[model samples]
Target: MKKIKIGIIGGTGGIGRWFAQYFQKEGLEVWVSGRRSGPDLPTMARECPVVIVSVPIAATLSVIEQIGPLMPEEALLTDFTSLKAEPVRAMLRASSCEVIGLHPLFGPEAKTLAGHNVVVCPARSRKWLPFVLDLFRKGRARIIETTPEKHDEWMAQVQVLNHLNTIAMGLALKRSGFQLAELLPVATPAFEAKVEWMKKIFGPNAGLYAQIITHNPFVEDVFENYQESLRELKKWIRRRDDEGLRKRIEQAGLFPAVRMKEE
Candidate 1:
C-alpha cells in the first residue's frame, strides 16, 4: 500500500518544524513550505494528500484559505492552531477536502505525544478522521474529541487563563522595586521556577503568547470572571478579615485537599 505524502506549510520553525521532523521519523514522506525556503504552498497542495497549516494563530486563517482550495478533494485540510473554531470554519469554507482541526495541548518542545492531550475537532471527514485518531492512538497521545467551539472554550479557561495569570505575576514583579538578581537570593525554589516559566512569554515567544491571550473570542469572558475573583480577594485582604478569607478558601474546595493531605 502506498502511504500518503503530508505537506506542512510554515514548516521552517516552531511547531511546524516539530511535525515535519516527527512525521518523517514515523517514516512518512513529508514536504515542507516556508516563507523563504522549501516548495511553495500551491505545489505542496497539488502534490501532497495531507496539507497541514502549522502557521501562527494570527496567520492561520489566511494560510488555510490559501492552501485549502488547492488541496485535492480527497486530501485532508488541517491546522495546528491553538484556537480551533475560526481555523476549522475557514478550512470548510475554502475547500471540499476533509477538514479536522487539531490542537496539541503541549508545545513543540514536547518529546512525545504520549500522555499529552491532542484535541481533535473533526469538522468534516470520512477518510481522514479515522486515520488521525489511529495515528495519535499509536503515538500514545490522549485524544480528546470535541466541537471546534468547545475546544476554543476550553482553551480560554486553560491556556488564556494560565498565561494571563503568569503575565500578571510578571508585571507585578516588574513593578516591584526588586530586580531578578535581587529576588533570586531571597526567592524560594518554586518562586524562581515560576519566574523562569514567566520569562518564556516575556522573551521571543511574546508574540505567540500575546495572540493566545488576545485572539480567542472566549478570553474576554475569562478576563471578566478573573477580575471578579480578584476584586473579591482584594476586598477581603484590604479589610484584613481572616474569617472572610478562610471562608473564601473553603468555598473554593481548597481546605478539603489540605485536610486529605494531613490525614
Candidate 2:
C-alpha cells in the first residue's frame, strides 16, 4: 500500500507540529513548510496529494492566496484556522483544488483526543470526506460536520468570548492588585477553576487571542452582552434590590434550560 503524502504549511507552529507528528504516527509521509522563501515548500506541496495550512488566522488567507495556484490540481487542501469562513472563501476563490476547513476545538496542549471535537467544513469534493473522517477517527477525535457560517458563529462564542472573559479576569486582577498565588488558598472551587483557565489563556501568544476576537463578527455582540450583564449586576447590587437580583438569577437559570432543550 502506498502511504499518503501530506504537506503541512506553517508546520513549525504548535498545532502544525502536532499534526505533523499525528499524521506521521498514522503512517502518512509528512512535509512541513513555513513562509520563508525556499524550494522545499513548493517541492513538498507539489509532491503531496494533500496539503494542510495551519498558520495563524491573520496569515491564513494570505498564505492561501500564495499557495492556491501552486498546489497540484488533484491535491486536496485544508486549513486548521480557528475562523473558517474567510479562509474557506479565500481558498474557494483562489483555486480549483478541493478545499476544506478544519477547526480543532481543543488546544495543542491536549494530550488525548478522547473527548475532543474537530469541526469539518467540506468544500469542492465528496471524495476526500471519508479520508478526512478516518484521519480524525485515528486521532480519537469526534468529528462535527458544519457549514462555514455555523462554525464561525459557534467559534465566536467558544473561542472569542471565552478568551475575552479570561483576558478580562486577568486585567481585573491586575487592577485590584491581587496576586494569583496569594488567592489560591482563599479561592473557591469556581474561582480556582477560572484561574486555571486564565493561566492557559495568558500563557500563550497574546496575538492569537487578539486575532480570534477581532476576526470574528459575533464577538462584538458577545462583549456588549458581557458589559451589559456587568452593569445590570452592579445596578442590582447598588439598589439592594433582592427581588430584582432574584428575578435575574431565575431568568438566567431558565435561559440555559431553553438553550439546552434547543440544542
Candidate 3:
C-alpha cells in the first residue's frame, strides 16, 4: 500500500486539528494549513496528495476557491462542512480535481471513530472512491454515501434539532432555577442522559452551534417546531386539562414506534 500524504486547510480549527492528528496517528504524512500565518499551507498542499478543507461553513466556498487552483492536479480534495450542497457546487465550479464533501457526525471531542458515522458525498470520480473509503475504514468509521442535498437535509435533523433541543433544555433549566446536578438524583435515566448531552453542548464553543443552526436552511423549521411544541406544552399545563395532557403523552409514546430501530 502506498503511503498517503494529507493536507488539512483551516488546520487551526478544532475539526481540522483533529483530522491532522488522526492522519498522523495513522502513519500518513499530514500537514496542517490555514489562511492565517500560524501555519504554512501552500507548501503542505504541494507535498500532500489529499487535501481536506475543514473551515467554517461560511468560509468553506471561499477557501475552496483559493485552494482549488493551487492544489496538485491529482490531489483529492474534500471538505468537512456540515452542509454539503453549496460546497460541492462551489468545488465543481472552481476545480477539476476529484472533489468530495464529508460530514463527521461526531465532534472533535470524540475519542475514536469506532461507532461514529461519517457522511461522504462523492463528486466527479470513481477512481478515488475506493481510496477515500479505505482511508475512513482504517479508522473504523462507518461511511454513508449520499448526495450533498440529502446530506444537508439529514443534518438539519441530526445536527440542528439535536443541538437546539439541548439548548432549549439548558435554557429551561436556567429559567426554572434548577441546578443540573441537583436534578440528577431525582431524574429518570432518560432525563439524566439528556442532561449529560446538555453538558456536552454547553461545554464548548458556541460559534460552532451557531453556524450549524444559522447556515442550514432546514433548521428554521426545526426551531419553529420546537417553539410550537413548547407553546402547546405550556398551554396544556396552564389549562390543567388532564385529558389533553394524557392524549399528548400517548401521542409522544407512539413516536418510538414510528422511528427506525436503533442499531
Candidate 4:
C-alpha cells in the first residue's frame, strides 16, 4: 500500500506547526518546509497529495503563485489564511487541483477543536471535498462552509474590527504617559481585563494582526464606520449630551444580532 503524504509550506511554527503535529498523530507522512529547510515547493507538489499553504498572511499569495502550477490535478490545494477571498481566487487561478480555502477560527494555542469553528470555502473542489471535510470532522471541529467572498466579508468585522479595537486601546494606553504597572494598580476590573486582553493579543502577534487589518478588502469600509462611530461619540462627549448618548447607546444595544447563548 502506498503511504499518504501531506506537505505544509510553512509548517515550522504557528498553526502550521499545530497541524503538522496533528497529522503526525494521524499516521500520515507529514513533510514540513521552512524558508531554509525541508522539502521545497516543487518536490512537495509532485509527491504530496494534499499541499497546504500555511505561511504568514503577507507571504501566502506569492507562495501559492510559486507552487500552484506544479501541483497534480488530483491533489488538493488549500490554505490556512484568515481572509479567504484573495487566497482562494489565487489558488483557483494558479492551480488545476481541487482548491479549498480553510480558516481555522482559533489560534495555535487551542488544545482541541471542541467548539471552535473551521470555516471551509470549497472553490473548484469536487474530487477532494470529502477528504478535506472528513479530516476536520475527525478533529471534532465545528465546520461552517461558505464562499470565499462571504468568509472575508464576515471576517472584516469579526477579525479586522476586533483587532482594530484592541490596537486602539493598546495605542491609547501607550500614549497616556503612564506605565502599565501604574495604570493596572488603579484600573477598574473591566478596564484591567481589556488591558490584559490587549496585551495578550497585541504584543507578540502584532504583525499577524496588522496583516489582518490591512489585507482585508473590506477594511476601508470598516475603518469608515469605526471613524463615524467615534465622531458621533466624540460629539456627544463634547456637548455633554447625556440623554443623546444614553439613547444612542440604548439603540445600539438593540442592534440586530442573534446573540449566542453563553457556553
Clashes per candidate, residues 3 or more apart or on different chains: 0, 0, 0, 0
Residues 1-263 of candidate 1 have per-residue lDDT tens digits of 78679898988889889878878877788999888899988899888998889888899888888887888898898989999999999999999989999988888889987899999999889988998888778779999999999999999989999999999999998998778998889999999899988988898999999998899889889999999999989989999999999878877875687867756
| Best prediction by TM-score | 1
By TM-score, is 3 or 4 better? 4
Which pairs clash (backbone N, Cα, C closer than 3 Å) in model 2? none
Tens digits of lDDT, candidate 3, 169-235: 7898899998877988899999988888877778767777878888887987888888888888997
Prediction 3 global C-alpha lDDT: 0.82
lDDT of 1: 0.89
Candidate 2: segments with Cα more than 4 A from true spot:
35-39, 254-263
Q: Please provide, for model 4 over 54-118, each residue's C-alpha lDDT reduced to its tens digit, 9 standing for 90 to 100.
A: 99999999999998999999899999999999999999999999999999999898998778899
| Winner by lDDT | 4
Q: Compute each candidate's TM-score over C-alphas.
A: 0.95, 0.91, 0.85, 0.93
Encode model 2's per-residue lDDT on 67-155: one tens digit a residue: 88777777888999999889999988887888888988877788876679999999776678789989999878999999999999998
Off by over 4 Å in 1: 254-263
Sort all candidates by TM-score, best to worst: 1, 4, 2, 3
Look at candidate 4 and give me any clashing residue pairs: none
